[model samples]
Target: MASQPIKSDGGSSSYYLIPNGARDLLDLIEHKRMEFGIGNIFKACYRLGEKDGTSKRYDLNKIIFFAQRELARLPKDA
Candidate 1:
């Protein structure tokens, strides 16, 4: 799910809300980061249903870190 990324006022964090189908991606990333003590930053990922205005939520620090990790792992050739 595509989402609008948000940043922190302190300039040290960020956040994004992905749709329900994307929850698995969040879970997978969280699992990978757990051993490194990085999961603490994630508050939770929730879907309020189609009737609700929004369907996803992410903590600033967690999402920001995840995004950085993804960027770092991108193939140099790509």
Candidate 2:
């Protein structure tokens, strides 16, 4: 399934999808550090329980995927 924009709850989807429109969001997504997945992870977490039916499940799954990516990107202790 395709990922929904952060503003999917209300405002026009176009606003968020536009690179120059939602600058902060795009910046977070484009960040290339150890915390690259932070934006998506937090967005997914915020969506949890906020929506009904499939949307809720989608958010949960999204969180899991981002979390895994985050964990893999982090250094593990021996």
Candidate 3:
């Protein structure tokens, strides 16, 4: 039988396909540092920073990561 991917209740899919013979210590390092603390519902807008080292008004928009509901379906109340 073929192996199936695992689906989490959070609506995300994950799978482990590494071979048993693989050996690489550096592979353990996180690519983007495991995200925690704040959730993924936030956006990263890069605008001109003030001289006082503070983020200025949002002059641009970029969706680093959007909410699942926003990506999945329309708002029910709308």
Worst 10 residues of 3 by lDDT: 34-43
Candidate 1 residue-wise lDDT, 1-78, digit = tens: 114545568655523443345556457455444433234333333222222443334344455676577567769884
- Number of the predicted model whose TM-score against the real structure is largest: 2
Q: Could you tell me every candidate's TM-score relative to the true structure?
A: 0.27, 0.46, 0.16
Residue 69 in model 2: shift from native, Å? 0.5
- Model 2: per-residue Cα lDDT over 26-75, one tens digit each: 46455422254677776567567676564777888888898888778768
Model 2 CA lDDT for position 21:
41
Give the C-alpha lDDT of model 2. Answer: 0.62
Could you tell me which 10 consecutive residues in candidate 1 have the lowest summed lDDT?
42-51
Best model per lDDT = 2
Q: Which portions of model 2 miss their true places by more than 4 Å?
A: 1-34, 49-54
Ranking by TM-score: 2, 1, 3
Model 3 lDDT at residue 48: 39
Give the Å error, residue 47, model 3. Answer: 5.9
Q: What lDDT is reached at residue 46 by model 3? A: 20
